[model samples]
Target: MIRRKGCSEKGRRSPIYRVAICEDEAPIREALLQMCRELLSQLAPEHQVEAFASARELAQALADGAPFDLLCLDILMEGQNGMEFAQKLREENERISILFITGSSQYLKDGYSVRPIQYLFKPVQREELEDALRTDLRLHHRPRTLTLRTGNKTTVLPIQDIRYLESQNHWVVVHMREGQQTFRSSLSEVERLLPPDQFCRSHNSYLVNMAWVAQTGRRELLLQDGSQVPVSRGYYESMQRQFVRFLNLK
Candidate 1:
């Protein structure tokens, strides 16, 4: 719940983002949780965080009205692969930020379809995670509420509360301010639902909100929260021009 200056007037309600992590491996999951705790302690102590070992378990939790702003997911899992889980999650909702984690580069092609915020290799590094999270928080726009359906159940998600979105195959994972949820959808489709001015397609596989942008150079996009997102050659020029214009407007 780190409120930006000039965001509130006296007693006005302040905005809070939710973050979550879903990794099947215990060691990796613990590492992610520790990193989250460290980052939030320094960057956004008021934000809430939750952890899950599998998509099914996390999905079930989200059904209870949890708000997840960001999600860090591992590709391969015991019951359901991350991709399959993401598809089921995005099918029901499309407004949260998602970041994928895996040890293999082969997953990259499949990942792009989901339009994750970014993809990170396993053995999760603190610096990389921090950069991704911060960039996501800065760029999010037009906070709205979303309703998701799973089997006979429905879940309500508040957009402002989301920190980011992650892609797993045909599924997109929604990370909110309170808890994490997954859905079945593509990154392109999720982009359609987001506000263009706020969320920018920085890479073929990633879309980031401008507000979270801390700094940008010819080759990189830095998030205020301290994460660095790559500016691919294909998208570099267009993103640079658009970002420059965005700055000028502000």
Candidate 2:
């Protein structure tokens, strides 16, 4: 089990989150290595970090069965670009979390097929990198129980108990198997707390758990409890790809 600094006691300690960064530029590569070391020290003290000057080097490392939790890849390089390398990585290991570090936004739309966790514009910002780390942590770590407050009472709920979330005017409604509970938080806030592989934003106002999905069509998702949620057209393709990956279908 992997343990994160701010995680609850019930949360299991994660196995070392081994990471690899692939870049061709010496200065950029070294900078990323330094940032990774600093961030891991603060957020995941026991994590392991590795660096490669090119995708070929990283690919060789991966072929050796060296488990990597996250991959920070650059879009352009001397030989194979990040996209091509990512394709190979996906073919080899579908579960590894990928984040692209690129100078251009042109490749952003193309990253969805690979199901990248996030895209960081170089030079990466501290806040952006930290946010990406938080996302990665949730993906690798199990959900923890959280204490939430109602009008006059405090209730402890395991994060896994939440099946979906809906946004109201200013508050978010958490829907569990038992019933719906209102919480004073934004949808984005709730999103940040949930695991990326388990949860997805289906609509502007709704987020659904893939675990409870009974069926999914082009524009809707049917939950195990017989609830149907609409999937926004904007997120349709990305959601479909993720759903397939989640089901281990391809």
Q: Could you give candidate 1's per-residue lDDT for residues 1-250 as a string of tens digits?
A: 1112211223221245577789888888988888888886644534677889998888887788666767777888889878777767778766667889888887788877667889989777888887677667556523355455656676766555544565678876765545667877677766655544456667776666666788877677877666676677888887876677557545
> Which prediction has the highest lDDT against the true structure?
2
Q: In candidate 2, residue 99 scores what lDDT? A: 90
Per model, how many backbone clashes are there?
Answer: 50, 6
Error of 1 at 7 (Å): 12
For each candidate in the order shown, give its overall lDDT on alpha carbons.
0.69, 0.77
Instruction: Look at candidate 2 and tell me the lDDT of residue 191.
Output: 68
Per-residue CA lDDT of model 2 for 115-197, tens digit only, reads 99899998888878877876777566444555666567776666667778899987988788889888777787666555566
Q: Which ten residues in a row have the lowest lDDT in candidate 2?
A: 1-10
lDDT, residue 172, candidate 2: 86
Model 1 per-residue lDDT at 45: 38
